[model samples]
Structure formats: C-alpha cells, structure tokens
Target: MSQTLISPGISVANDDKQRLGPRTRFGLLASITVTFLAGSSVPTPLYPIYQDQWHFTAMGISFIFSIYAISVLAGLLVFGRLSDYVGRRSVLLWTTVLQLVAMYMLGVADGFTDLVLGRLIQGVSTGAAVPAVGAALIDLNHKRGAVVNALTPAIGSAVGALMGSVFAQALPYPTHTVFAALAFILVIQGVGLLLMRDIRAKIPGAARSLIPQFSIPVDVRGPMIIASSLFVAGWAVAGFFASMGPRLIEQLFALPASWAGGLVLAAFAGSGVAAIGAFVTRSMHTLAWIGALGLLIGMAMVLVSLITGSLTPFVFGVVISGAGFGAGFQGGIRLVLSKSRAEEVAGVLSVAFLCCYLGMGVPAMIAGYAVASGHGIFDTAIVFAILVMSLSFIAVYRMISGGSRV
Candidate 1:
C-alpha cells in the first residue's frame, strides 16, 4: 500500500522457499484453480439450448457471451493488481464465492437479461481467479516450471467445457443440472481452500496501499507489448470456439445440440496436452515455434472447413487451433515469468490478460449483434474466422521475425 515499490523479484527474504511439499499441496492448488476456471466455461456448449428455451437471437447470445469478457476485464482492472497486495488465498476464496453467485444466476435464468447478467458475473469471477491462481502456481513452485502452472488453467478449461457440455446436453433439466454440478464443485473448492495451509512470500509495506498500480521496467515494455498481442490473438481463437462453434455445429453439420460441447472440449484438450508437454520438454524455443506453426496450420484448417462445410473437418480444425492456442499461451507465460519478479507479476500479467479478455469479448459481441437482426449466422461466422486467422498469422509472422519470441 505504501508508495515505495518493493524492489522486483520475489518479495520475500526467501523467494525460493518451498513452503508446501511440491507434490501433494501444489497439485491440490492446481486442481482447485482448474475446477473453478473450467466451470467458468461450462456454459459454452449449451448457449444454443438456452437460445431455444429463451427465444434469443445469435446476437443476443453474443451479448451474453460478451459479459464474461467484460466482467473479466473489469476484474483485472479493479482487482488484478489487488492480489499483489493481498495474499493469493484470500483473493481466490472470494473468487470462488463469485463463481457460486454466477452459477446460481445462470441456473435460474429466465430471459436474455438474466443470461447477460449471469455471464458478466462469471466473467468477473474468472478474471479475478486467473491472476491469483496463476500467480499462486508460480509462487508455490520450488523448482522453476511453466508447463505445470500454465496447464492448470489450460487443461482445466478444456476438461470443464467437456464435462459441462456433455452432461448438460445428455442430462435432463440441463439449465439447473449443469449449474448444480458447478455449485457443488464450488463448495468443494471452498472446503479445499479452508483446508490448505497458507503459503505466500510476504512483502513489507506492500499491503497498505489500496490503489492498483501497474509498473514494468522500460526495457521489458517492448516484450510485454508483443506478449499482449500474442495473448489477444490466442484468446480470440478461444472465444470463437466457445461462442460460435456450437452454433456452427448446429446450423451446418446438423449435429444434435448435445454434442456441440465436444467440439469445445476437443480444442481445449488438444491445447492442454500440448501445454503440459511444452512444460516438460525443456526446449521452450521449440515449443514456441510449434505454437506458431500450429496456429498457422490450425487457422488454415478452419478456413478449409468453412469452405468445405464438413463437421468432422470443422471439429478437427478447432482442436488443431486449440493446440496452437495452448502452446502459444504457454510460451508467452514462460517469457513473461522469466522477465518478471514477484512484486511485478500481477501487474505485468494483468496487462497480457486484459488483452486476452478484450479479444475474447469484444469481437464476439460485435458478431453477436450482427446475428441478432435476422442476418445469417454463416456471414458472422465467416467474418470471425477471417479476423482471428488474420491476427494469428500476423502475430506468428512477427514472432518469427524475432520481434516477440513468445
């Protein structure tokens, strides 16, 4: 809270201390973050069903989806840097509570307004949770590793989307049932938070100041800017998968609404696996290029699927794209972490995540608005595919030029 910034790097006397055993406690923390983060996207595959039940248009669906991004952006701006001052546990506990509120709202949604409001709350919860959860993973590490930390959120997103979509589509009373499952998981996470021992390196005089400040050294700013761009591109890919894929599947492939979630899950699962592998491979440079290449190939695949009108190709394209997204995200986190210190972690990472949520939320909303007025879903989907693919190719090209390695 004080005006005096703690010198960067780990904020404690022993930044390298292993407070909890690496295996059990770390896994527990990762699991907790994954469960709730995944829940945030649990509703992705079911938006069509909601539309059918509520008589909302595609534009309305986009608006509802946009709330999550807007909420996440708001959370990052307001509370993104707060965890730097407060302990991670405190922030995470509160985030869990927010998720509960969101699920409750969604479980009983009656109209378009309810859907938008509920998604907004879920967005805020996830936005707050991501930085805290991500920072906590890095903080808990005795040995340096990016894959494990990155995979926590990456894999969780995939698995959660899969579970939520499959169960919601297959089960009776999806609206209530899916959220019921999420609410139960939130309760379980709350208990886990209570049981886990608090482990954080404290900074003297850091907590007293309440104002959120974002600071990075002059030299690091260039890399940070480029990292943010990469985040934007990757997140746009993710947003499309969540918002548009289900609708596309329903309209084009004639797939049952229930199986749409599987498409989202496949992409996340591909990305999660790639992220974990990237973490352990010890050649981050290789992984970075892998991400770039994946993005190019995956985006191309998506364009092809659009042209061919094949469901199998479309789903496959999504998974390939997701693999690229995860790989790129993992690489970016590694670059940021290597360049950052503990005091600066939340502030620096917040900027990158801000770009991500912006990418995820903004365009999707615009596309949604387009869909709402009796315009064709395919027209909007085409625009989305083009925009995301363009951004991704540009980022990859810049990185290939050695402008942004991550």
Candidate 2:
C-alpha cells in the first residue's frame, strides 16, 4: 500500500489504483480479440437447435445469420475508426457493456425477434470492439500485430464453433448456456478494462462527424480490389460454413448427432487458420494463383463427396478450401497494409472488412433462399463453387496481367 498526500497533511493508502505490467496488458488485449470474435460464431453450432425449436425454414436460419452481418457492416460504416477519434479504451469499454447486454438477451430469448435483436446487438458490440482492439494490439506490439490480427478471428471463430457444439451436445439449454458462459467471460474482461490504463490518445474532431465514411486510397485501389476480391471469394465459402454447412451436411449426407454440423465448420476454419502462415510469406500474385488453385480443387472434392455420398471427400474439401480461404484473405490484407499510408490504415481496413463480410453474408442469404425454394443443394453448391473459382481465377489473371505486381 502506498500513501498519497492530499491537502498537504493528509495521506491514505492508494492500493486500489494499481498498474499492470506490459505483458499483462498485451495479454488482455489479445484475449479481448479472441473472446469478441468467438462470440460472433458461438451461435453457429446452435442454429440447428434454434431451427428445431422454432420450426423455421432454411431461409429463416440464413436471415438470422445475415442480420448479424448487416449490423456489423452498419457499425463499421459509422464507427469503424471511432477509436481514432475517441480513445480506444473508452470505445471498448462501452461496447463491452453493450455486448454484455446482448449476451443476456440471447440467454433469455424465447422468440425470433429476441434472437435477431441479440444477434444485431452482438454485431454492434463486436463491430465496435474489433477496430479498437486491433488498433490497440498494434499500439502495444507492432512487430506481432499484423500476424495476430490476421489469425485471431479465424481461430476464434473455429474455437467458438467447436466449443458451442461441444456445449450443446454436453449441456442443457444449448443456446442459453453457451451465450451465458460467454457473457461471464466478457464481464471479467469488462471489469479488467475499467481498471487498466487507457493507451490511445484522443484525436481532434472526434465529435465533428457522425456521417459514414468510405473509400479506397487511390494509390492502393487496384491492388486492394484484387486482394479484397480474393478475401470476398474465400469469405463466401467461410460464410456458408458458418451459416448453412451443418444443415447442408445433414440434408445431403444424413449426418447424425446435433453437434456434427458445428464440427465441420470448425474444421474448415481451423484448416484455414493453419494455412495462413505459409501463404502470407509469398508474393501477392503467387498467393492469388495458389489460392485460386486451392479453391478449385477443394470445391471439386466437395462435388465428389456430394456425388459419392461420402463424408471423407467433403471433409477433405473443407481442408483444401480452408487453405485457399487463408491464403486469399491474409494475402490481401497483408498486401494492403504494406502499401497503405498511415492515415489510411483504419479506413482501408474497414473497406476490406466490408467486402469480406458482404461476401460472407449476402451470398449465403441468396443460397438460403434457393435452398428454401426447393433448389437442389448439390446444384447450388456447384454453382456457388463455380462462381468462387471464377472470382479466384480473375484475381490470378489480374495478378498475371500487372494490375497488381509481385
């Protein structure tokens, strides 16, 4: 306990105002990234459960998932760089509180409206927290920052999908329990943030505009579009995994057990996480070709699985597809960051995320409608795969044609 002077003569123990060491601070920020992103997918495993109890159609499930994407896009469009204006710590703290509220809503949700509202709130919470957390992580450790940012969300979503499935299989009230558990973890983090020192200085004109801002800096536009297109293509598959992979597996393969669907998604994401590193070290053009090739082989394998009524080919397809996902997404983000002006970093990154999530959300919804309207699942997968391959090859050709260089 230490004493501090007050009014010249009075002194009291100031033990409550404790300061954390650097390692602890870094750990806290990293943990926040993991937990926030994990929360984003915790519902993936539970979607089936919701479908069963609520008696909703496939389109309903897709809409439920899509709404979260919309909420995130809206949040990023408005507040993506708010931390650059406001203090990062302050923005994180408030969003964390809202996140807690969202979790509580999920726990008690008995209706579709409640569920959608919770997801939207979650979108806002994660949306607001991600940029600040990313910015703060870089602030604390620039050397490892880029790698961490690239891998953390994929890994976190994988963990969430796996654990949510596990919890659903092992515990009661799968949806309520999973969200409640996440809420508890968030509470501890929120309280910790309240005590930790703020790191980012508040910039001027933080309150000057609430209008949505968007653009690609002119110099980086061509390369950014190519990279972002790859991200979009990869994320399209990623979104399918998160929203409909489980249901599709059940429908097509007659997979048993409620948790099996989530496991597939976890595998897909985990494989991508594993592949991100080897791909990131390559030149952007090389990454484009490799990613395109991986995606093609992966989708073809998935087609083989669908044709043969075999789970093995599908699982293998997931792995190869995941590698392409990692390669395309990470390579794009890395290239953009390498070339972005310091001031353009946050805004440009927002554009990248907007594209990535748009890919994740929009296509999944369309596929959902098609499936719901009696379109054959295998036929839809074939069409989607073809579209993704076309985008990937276009990226490769763009790279080859010198729109973007090595």
| Top of the candidates by lDDT | 2
lDDT of 2 by residue, 208-308 (tens): 52468777788777778678678788888888878888777887888743587788878877887887776656765666667767777887788788778
Q: Kindly report which residue pairs in candidate 1 clash with one another.
A: 1-206, 1-208, 1-209, 9-342, 59-368
Candidate 2 TM-score, true structure as reference: 0.90
For candidate 2, the 10 contiguous residues with the lowest summed lDDT are 6-15
Each model's C-alpha lDDT? 0.70, 0.77
What is the Cα root-mean-square deviation between model 1 and the actual structure?
A: 3.9
Instruction: Please give the lDDT score for candidate 1.
Output: 0.70
Which runs of model 2 end up more than 4 angstroms from their true locations? Answer: 1-18, 277-289, 403-406
Write model 1 residue lDDT over 237-304, tens digit each, in one string.
Answer: 77766777687777777776546655555565556467557555555455555566666677677777
